[model samples]
Target: MTSPTISQIGEISLIDDIRKQFSQKLRDVTVGIGDDAAVIKPREKYLLLTTDMMVEGVHFDLRFITAYQLGFKLISVNVSDIYAMGGIPRHVLLTIALHKNTPAEFVHMLMNGVKDAMTLYHAVLVGGDLSSTQDGISLSATLIGYAGKYILRSGAHVGDRIYVTGSLGDSACGLHVLKKMKRTVSLNKKNARGSMHSFCKKLGAMHGGPARSGLSWKIVEPLVRRHLMPEARNPQKFIRDATAMIDISDGLLIDLTRLCNEGSTGAKIYEEKIPVSIEMKKAAECLGIDPLTLALTGGEDYELLFTARQGKRVSATCIGEITESQRVIVNASGKERPLSVGGYRHFQ
Candidate 1:
């Protein structure tokens, strides 16, 4: 006999079943899973908490990733959220749903990844839950951090310089590569040289691999790894002077629109000023997609999009200045036009 599947019960029904398993009252819990994270009030400091879930098909593919990489990516993504809020991460709770036959060694590797990330960020892994799943692995992590002052999306002022940490569109490029590898493997299943296993090993060693003749490894691998294990740029020290801030999980255009809408303001962004990586350009050329659109609409960059006062103590470059028009404008060459607000919407 076959077991019942989650799809058979539906998304809402699965959520209801999970909700029923948890206790009604959780100690020291001011907030819980329904929101970003469970907020617990501390006597001496203000607590900021958030959680992120990584689903196998949606967020990752198990065939191309090692357990160690999966573990690190999971923690890094959540830590990025904490950094976005201008907070110092202190602790994390992990909940993992795994298939029954998964190896214990894989679990150990995942734990090692979590442990390494926690040490790097000064975050402690306090506790969590583990359960069996029928389909694929699911990992969720809740991070608790503290902040003297919280920087929110609704705090922009006119004339503030908009700045972003790091270049964009690397993750989208990486996804393209991974998808291409998968397709190639599917078409040539019997060939050992061009197999998915070979691709996975190549991806794993990409950082240390020999540079291709006439191509720079320095330029290529960083972009691929940027998608795999992006370093969270913690700007808690800089937030004291920030007028408004947001994480660039989505593309710049979309995330900027979010900031504008939240702050009830408008902005002007220069097309030439937006940073574009060389690898992004290469990938765009190969895919026949516009690099600007990728930089504008590609999601999961995890860089911070922030507005700060000119000549502020914190160093930042001005991409554009905020405008009073209540619209997002993009200036390219001598041409100036309004940029459409486009981003990843779950239902749409």
Candidate 2:
């Protein structure tokens, strides 16, 4: 039996199904899907708006990732921007363009991912536009959030300390491993635990297997999962004392450079202080890649990197301090080099 495609299902029916899937009643939402536009109630706090796009070839590859993961990541990446400003995500709008021949099952899985992410973030899906594309998929999301007080990248002072909420480089390393495997691994809760043995067997068969180098499923699972479904870090705990903030979406050096540029200041971070997970280290070694390079220059970690004034207690890892004029990275042996930006850029 041939499975139904979007072309066979028709746009009207698909949209109606989508509306039913996301139907929700929220206090702030006056009008949701099935309306011309969404109406949102005004809030007393400051409003934070952000939008992000994920194009098929440019942002992701379907071969290495599932539609479910893609949908979840689309919401996560946008929410990270709001969290970077110390805000609580409230509402969401999505726009998706897909090839008419795309499978209905794929669309359903994608929506399930999106719905799960919306629930995880306590956000409501209000309204969005859907369209047919000639070729690849394009997804965009707009997130609305509220904050009593927001942090900005331009607020750092020369004496502030720089911090990161969690470990880095795992996503980049995971991506590398996935590219080598040339396959997808489902990290969904229901199926992952029972399928580890088969997944490891598949991993072992790839190019003599990095598993031969002691990269077990335990080591590879987290790395790939990080790439597939990264949760945005909420800055509520550190927002009070944060002098400056940005999410590590495009690598530490590039994002830190952005923060420094916004503040018209400089920074000095110690190489030894940058956090790298044990899994990432082992995986990188098996792949013959430098863990520090991935940590410093890789993209899409979504960890919050912020600065705070000295003498205040912060729950994040303090890797550096703000400087008066020069941006540099201090090595373990006291060697200093200019901090150069490196990460994903659309155009060369």
Candidate 3:
């Protein structure tokens, strides 16, 4: 039987369902849903606030993502901002607008994704609003966090070493693979195990019944997963030593430029030191693209880019160091050139 749509359920029912889904009592929250405003207990630590929006046909394409993945990614994106400041996420507020024709099942899946992500971050859903739209979906989230000592993008100084929490370009390469496959992969734990069979079979069929361009599911899976459901990297391990920080949401060069501009300093990075995964390398080769270009310009990786004082012990990959007045990249052959300030900009 076909499921009902949101219009049939009414707005009040929809709000009630969401409220019940996240009705947990937390010590930090005195009032949650059903209230005019949420009451959060004050904390001694510094409070961090951040918000992000995802619009249909602009920020995302439903054809490439499931409602569950969409919900999870929205939360993760905002949480990354808090983490970039070296803060711990504690509370969340969401605003979602969907067409009246949107299926009830889609709403259920979306809330499931949101709930699971909140649980993962140990955060509570204090409150939010819901509304019906005319055509497509629009989602926004506000994340509140706390930290004893917060890091900023303007804190880097000359002689500080630049570090990245993990490998880059995986998410961008994954996006390329998805565009070729023209399909969505369900990443829920219950269905993730068997998702590969369908992902490979369909993609193979598109390219004459074999993995496309000699790329197997093992290699493609991580790339696509990185794009669909990226996890926010925690900075707790090295937060104390970090002098400056930002998350690579818009691409390495653009975000790095923001950090440099904030501190009024220049940066020099080594191409050999930039971390690129083996999966991305092979996939990029098969797709006839340059891996380094992807690593440098591909955005939405959600990895942390930070700076720390030189000679300090840091566990992350040290890619380069801060310079006095020039931003350049050193090639393997020792060629020096200006760093390109290119990334995902809103208006061209």
Model 1: colliding residue pairs: none
Clashing pairs in model 3, backbone N/Cα/C closer than 3 A: none
**lDDT tens digits, residues 1-348, model 2?**
666999999989988898899888878888888778999885746989999999999999999999999999999999999999988998999999999999999999899999999899998899888899988899999999998888899999999999998899999988987887787787865676556656555655553564475667788888898999999998876546798999999899999999999999999999999999999998887777788999988889999999999988899999999999899999999999889763333212
Error of 3 at 17 (Å): 0.9
Which segments of model 1 are wrong by more than 4 Å? Answer: 1-44, 183-216, 236-240, 343-348
**Model 2, CA-based lDDT:** 0.88
lDDT string for model 1 (7-118, tens) is 4544455444444433244445556444555565553256788999999988888765667767877888898888887787876788989776666556666777777777
Rank the candidate models, highest TM-score first.
2, 3, 1
TM-score per candidate, in order?
A: 0.76, 0.94, 0.93
Report the alpha-carbon TM-score of model 3 versus the true structure. Answer: 0.93
Greater-lDDT candidate between 1 and 3: 3
* Candidate 2 C-alpha error for residue 238, in Å: 4.3
